[model samples]
Target: MTVTAAAHDGGIPAPAPGTAPQQVTMSGAINRALRDAMTADTDVVVFGEDVGTLGGVFRVTDGIARDFGPDRCFDTPLAEAGIVGFAVGMAMAGFRPVIEMQFDAFAFPAFEQIASHVAKMRNRTQGRVNLPIVIRIPFAGGIGGVEHHCDSSEAYYAHTPGLKVVTPATVEDAYTLLREAINDPDPVIFMEPKRLYWSKGSLPEDASPDAQIASSFGRAAVRREGIDVTLVAYGPSVDVAMQAASAAMGSGWSVEVVDLRTLVPFDDQTVVASVRKTGRCVVVHEAQGFAGVGAEIAARVQERAFHSLHAPVLRVAGLDIPYPPPKLEHLHLPGVERVLDAIARLQWDDQADALHLPESSPACDSPASDSKGGAA
Candidate 1:
């Protein structure tokens, strides 16, 4: 497969006000990455529903069109299939076209194109063409919009062969992953957690030039280190996992959070290492617990870390039912309580310190009913 990556000028990376990393929101980092990629490569084009004028439903594309011009970054008809179908042709013609799915569920209309053409064109053509396309999807529950807006449908894409599925759980990864996805020789489903779009983090000013989690087409990140349990997650669940870990700390339990940045390549190495060290694992996600991404992770851990595991790998995930309305979402989506509950069930070596949770903990709810948009 033939491919080319964007070149960044060599310079000292900067952090925040002090020696700390620069504070950035996930959405802001993605916008920055888009601008950087488009600036570095004229062949890069971005377009989707309301992505140009409305700056996207979340304003992630706010100033892109204005700064890059209509031709480079513009809006498109309210047609998901046409958008992706056209991109397939563009990529074959040697143009890098980045697409915004607006919402996770909204991408359904283009499923045929994605699963059939966009995904297989590279191998189907016997390496004659490379679909270096990045399909950006803002997914998962918490935004509290209507149905078809909060679905964690990553499995559908991840299940499809020839397609690379990835989700970034941190601000820095959001930036770096998108840039990497756009440069990939194959089609990439870049799923961004809509709930975490406003989540805050920092970009270290001193960042590596050659370092990113794309060398293996995927990489799991260790958000926190602990010896007791490994809490594995991706996308919005990363935030929930971190919250659970923080809460577990108060209960005298040490918890490690593993962010599976790229789901398709399945970063088994990092996750297995963490599970082996902790001897316990709990996979979390907004997707249904049955046959969801968590199931695959739990199974893999069981096979690879069988000797090291002290308890069966548990999973904290959404109910198998369809995405619920905004009011009932809390009862369905995976949350800090669910994660902690799963951890509590794990058989631990030291039962000395019980998980006596505080009577009241902070609520980790997403902007539910009040959130705008209808695609999950």
Candidate 2:
């Protein structure tokens, strides 16, 4: 079907800001967004393994095929690369195709299609064509599943030049951000934290633009603001960061939390500003410590807030080994305890009982200098 400008423009509008919160799970909110987008725009097509009859592994696309019909919402073969290539072709022809990767690790096979074609197409064509495809991958640990089932690979996509990387922490963002990604002209890698699928939150009934989360690319949302220390996080790690903040509060430390909703084109400005205020910063993520998102953020913080920094930038992230078995996953993923431990390190050596810095350490020079706080 042809996608007209008007057809893509109108749909169930987002409810007004602060309106009634439609209590729903994160997966439900994503499903709602996909449904609304598909209903509004006939050109919007969704396809992936088992998405048709099974509603996807996590049921995030449940009932979409039945409601939208097989043509609009259907399943594809078990080839991730083929799925992405097909979607890229569809997008080139002016169709908005939303492809789903069964799991985080499953997306790797499609990496070639995404990195070489989907991401670089527009830039290669110099605006002659746009790949407005959305590749959704259920990611992150904490479901008690096996290795490949729960990997957080945001850093890989964020490191890519032409792809927009986004991870929603709350139900409200899950709905709004998905809709926004579908509407955007560029390709978007939408990373959904699998553990949060069942987590519930309030959503709006009617469509209001304000209620819609801002489609600010590469921007971070200040989940909470404080003056003592700044906690940087995304996806599943965001929950851990908040818990750390609460724990530190008991010790009379006010912590600021920044959720980098979009990783690529990250909102370094927000992070820099917060770090400038708090003077101490800790980055948290579920990915391994080596070359992970936390490493990138820590580097940026050093570059932007070098003088303002009280203590060196710290990172709380997953271990270097492959994602462990479900039983040992707790040790693999960063938790509130790990975050609190980092916070305590930040508060150490304070003379007036305020957050203080130790003697200028080597870590203070550059984020790359210390692999301990760098990527796993």
Candidate 3:
């Protein structure tokens, strides 16, 4: 009755004409996955708020309902809890449900069903029934989204038992991971970093667009190779980590980057291996620091690669406070400057191993702005 979490290696089926294996936005790639999954499995249904006629707020689900008909792809009432509860029933009845959670903070209303039923049904039934549900949530900070629009809530699901959690930062992963989530036998929290929706990346010129999954969702991918330090990130903040790595190269530091693609079945081996090679590690995420995903990654790195460590495992994360308003978000979310600043803090020389404390306990690191609990 015990169900373990799982993941997949990215794969896509043969591509149709015009849908080339070229550069595509993350949203576009996801759209391709939805198209192919529905084409492959009639039991797979997609439903959520504003998902049908509207094509979803971000158009990730566009053209789906029109082509697939209301029975396969449709909209639901504005109740998150009901949407998930109904989907759970459908899953129990042999249908594979792929639901969309419009926003990060908006997914909470459905959390009751997600944690209580969607997550535990497989084990509770003693393997009689499994919930193959993919709850796609558009999350993370950036894009000037305010209030309930921007929140990194993946830790909640990742901490919950029985649920497989993952986030994709690249276009290829967007297509491949969503496809894998739909095909997984258990419930999966597919967190899509909304900020990266428009970010484009190249795919093989002749690759297929159908669907491909390699079953390596639990393994982290090395985005860059180096020896001085390891920079770990996933989802939206991965771009920030890459920027820091490039900047570090100019400063005579060879930095390595590891994208922790999946959260629940964390790829400890890949990240720990990177730390063992670099001797220093930094985990970055748009989520807050305390009890965050980064904390677990840092702990694992220290535990497995302790002997190879040259310094403490540092973390670059969003401010602990609630997400700021659109205008003031710049100071809240971790950016290139923040990442580089953290990278610069790692001691590279033996003589500078001793830590240097700030001259005074001043909260104002930049004279331009005061952290007066932001009025905007």
After superposition, the stretches of candidate 1 with alpha carbons farther than 4 Å from their true spots are 1-21, 204-216, 349-376
Give the per-residue Cα lDDT of candidate 2 at 175.
Answer: 86
Q: Give the TM-score of candidate 3.
A: 0.88
Candidate 1 clash pair list: 13-205, 14-205, 15-205, 16-21, 16-22, 144-368, 148-376, 149-375, 149-376, 150-376
lDDT tens digits, residues 66-92, model 1? 666788878889899999999998988
Q: How far is candidate 2 from the true structure (C-alpha RMSD, Å)?
A: 6.4
Q: Could you tell which candidate, 2 or 3, scores higher by TM-score?
A: 3
Task: Tell me the deviation in Å of residue 297 in model 2.
Answer: 0.6
Candidate 3 wrong stretches, greater than 4 Å: 1-20, 203-212, 351-376
Q: Tell me model 3's lDDT, rounded to 2 decimals.
A: 0.82
Q: TM-score: which candidate is best?
A: 3
Better of 1 and 3 by lDDT: 3
Q: Pick the candidate with the highest lDDT.
A: 2
Candidate 2 TM-score over all chains jointly: 0.87
